[model samples]
Target chain A: MLAMRELSVGFAGGLALRRATLSVARGERLGVAGESGSGKTMLGLACLGMLPEVAVVTGSVRFDGGELVGAAERDLRRLRGQRIAMVFQEPLSALNPLRRVGELIAEPLRLHRGLSRAAALDRACALLSEVGLPDPASRLRQYPHEMSGGQRQRVTIALALACDPDLLIADEPTTALDVQVAAHILALLRALSESRRMALILISHDLRAIAAVTDRLAVLYGGDIIEEGPTADVLAAPRHPYTQGLIAARPTLSARRDRNAPLPTIPGTVPALAHLPPGCRFAGRCPVELPVCRSTRPAGNPACHRGGP
Target chain B: MLLSVEQVHRSYRMPRRRMFRAPPVIAAVQGLSLTVAQGEVLGIVGESGSGKSTLARLVMGFERPDQGRVLLNGQEAHRLPAAARRQTQMVFQDPSDSLDPRRSIGWSITEPLLAMGLRAAERHARAADLLARVGLAPADMHRYPHEFSGGQRQRIAIARAISPDPALLVADEPVAALDVSVQAQVLNLLLELNLTLGLAMLFISHDLAVVASIADRIAVMHHGRIIETGPTARIVSAPAHPYTQALFAAA
Candidate 1:
């Protein structure tokens, strides 16, 4: 199992993330959804021990009996490809431009497993096939620029799975992709997790994408985990007013919008880090907001008014 | 018609020539035609390279069509006088990059008005009113783009687009940047504006479910041509084109 406790971090005067506590069971997919500055990316990178020097992390992170928050740099480096793998947001930028596709995919296996060249090559091709890449062998020598966006993303997935790690954390994995290609890649990931029984952390802003993939969902706002519950329940009837507001505002289920309809708009923007509200972070924009909302933070509850067990 | 794109055919001149005999061409858009009635939304849906964006540019008058015509309110859109064409506006996909970071949100929102020679006091009041209409408070006019979240920044973009009360609004994948819930909010805003202003819209997106929401009529484009077009409910429930069916199936 992978879990976090009170994980908090921030960027130069901007609170990127805050008070985040989430977990993923061995065979489940946990989705982390939030906006640009909401700290979703910081939390993911912090887990990989890759946070920028400016980011100050304060919290405990546990994965499969090991701790990540305070682990030494050298030890964390060893743990990365062997125990956990991260598929970055941008495929082409994350990958080495000069390296051939095959070699790049096999890099983790070569480093962590100390496999021979032939063995690494064989494993790379298998991993490529697993990501649903066509002509895996024929594209071994292709450069990153030579491949399409979908292909490059597939190769990146192959690289992350080089070691078949227990935990896979993907941050905004398909942000740049269109729906069809994004869906195909998502299905590929699901298949991979089912086959390997690996824990998956899918971080994205798109609820539908996460809804189509995740087993449980956590809504991140103003750097805090406002709500966490089963995906369907949370989606169908969100408990937290903020979650409800998000639903009313999205176009995903707004198939009934006609000329006479009222467009649901969430009032106000998220408060900045330097200006994190004294009460609920979302109180400023909450339509059902009460006086207490501006004076005190609400406790995180699995049972909120909108959707709860 | 607020905007009209008729039989637009844009072909790129491929690089390299043996002897400059004739340049090879890559057809980006071929025989494409689209119209947006005032306050009516026409959704353009397709995958990358389907030429949906090219269609937007042609309608925006940023790119001249290689063939056919683009008329805005019964006149040439791009070729109209600067003051006349300013009646049209656009809201881009990514608000972060689309907005000018160096300037405050107030400046960016009122800049267009300033360029059009609106009095500073009037433009300021108009900007504030526009902000409130899009769900932001009038007070937020002083904040920079970096101060708001993705969803809120998008609101700012919407306000900027509608500040001039342009007859036509072209939004290219407006909600694509947002989270599912946030996307719902933005869509709701657009839908409301569509009702209130009766503003004609060209809503371009790759997500079928999104187009299924606010679009009055849906056009499915593949390669450079629109393979199918119909009302939202009919097109979604009973897509005629094989590609449209496949798209729905994949989604």
Candidate 2:
């Protein structure tokens, strides 16, 4: 159970995430989809109290009736591995090259659960098996570099599940993997969340990845959550102009498109953070922007002037 | 055919793990053959370790295949002189890495022209013209790569790739590093270039949907071999191979 009320993350350049309110219930899978610089990653980091030192975070983040915003580093550290574990996009960098896979998974268990080395390692082996890794016993002794990208990602997932976290924040978890491997990872995440009753926040720029695993979706644009609804509903009939543009932009297998025709693309690139308009972040690039959109902020779940595209 | 790769085979030796053991060789490309006609967009779809990039290198004459031949304009690509090799230009995945951040965009775009012995005046004129062609302002020529966004930098990369007026363009995941919305823009630019310039492209990507959007023909690669090759529509509609079917399902 987590609730974020008007949370904003800002740097010297500008606010990267602005007045965003979101919540996730137990065992819920929430997908945060956005382009680069859309602040999807920042929102995930803010939940774990893992923002950069220079980031100025504002508003409230409540988890399990505990306020995480402005909590002490020690308090955050205690909750991190035990309650809210994260899986990053780059699995290789997340894992230590020098450490064996078993040790990596076992350390978190030992630290958080106070298990003996042998007991922790045994639990680690079980976790490896739980995440569907083959030969869990043998995989424990191998280094991160010894495994393939997909295997390394599985190991990382095992490490995250070591302490049986209540929430898992996977930021572009499958971004670096191949298509088939990516599908496997997404399936694994969905299965894990359902079986373990863990809340998952899957952040990615790819709409297809989001569409595959998440039931609820939040579309971020230039640091703001412009649209939030059922993933299927939002994808099928997006109300916001920016959301429409994003859905249209993605190449789809279902569509029989003319090969010579150009894809439907948003008119302009995302403006620099410092140069973003005070109103809607998608204003300048939006296809049907009213004059008021340029100077005034639009509000609502879809966050638009004339909704229902 | 504008370009043909004939039974190409390439391999690399793996590091030996034990003493007194011969290092094992890893086959990256194995007896792979394909052809791209003039102005045709040939999409190569494959996962990592599938040797798609190795094929690009072989086609570009950057590396000689251990066996078979890579022929460009009916000539051995690896044996072609530097001047002749200029007919092929490449656009890489990450524009930031491919571009020199310190250099002005104009200078980088015109570097290929320099290699072809173009005078300074003509190079500048061509660079300005190329920037406009890619949908960037002519004034952006003076701006450095760091000044632009990822999408804009890719537009600059495209401008550079086309400056030489190459007969064939080898784009290895050109839009992979870009955002979804921005990826569409770049893909559109590539499509426009293909239509207007009649530039044959070796479009390589892991995204089946993206390949489907741009390519006239699609080749599905697995374990360093072409498992399926057909018209793009046919490949997407009714894939013959199970691997291709699985790939489509995954995408």
Candidate 2 local lDDT, B128-169, one digit each (tens): 899999999999899999899999999999899898889999
TM-score of chain B of 1: 0.96
| Model 1: TM-score, first chain | 0.94
Candidate 2 structure quality by residue, lDDT tens digits, A125-213: 99999999999999999999999999999999999988889999999999999999999999999999999999999999988888888
Deviating ranges (above 4 Å) for candidate 1: A10-19, A253-255, A288-292, A303-309, B17-24, B96-107, B113-153, B163-165, B179-182
Q: What is the iRMSD in Å for candidate 1?
A: 3.0
The number of the candidate with the highest TM-score is: 2
* Model number with the top DockQ: 2
Q: What is the lDDT of residue A49 in candidate 1?
A: 76
Candidates' interface RMSDs, in order? 3.0, 0.9
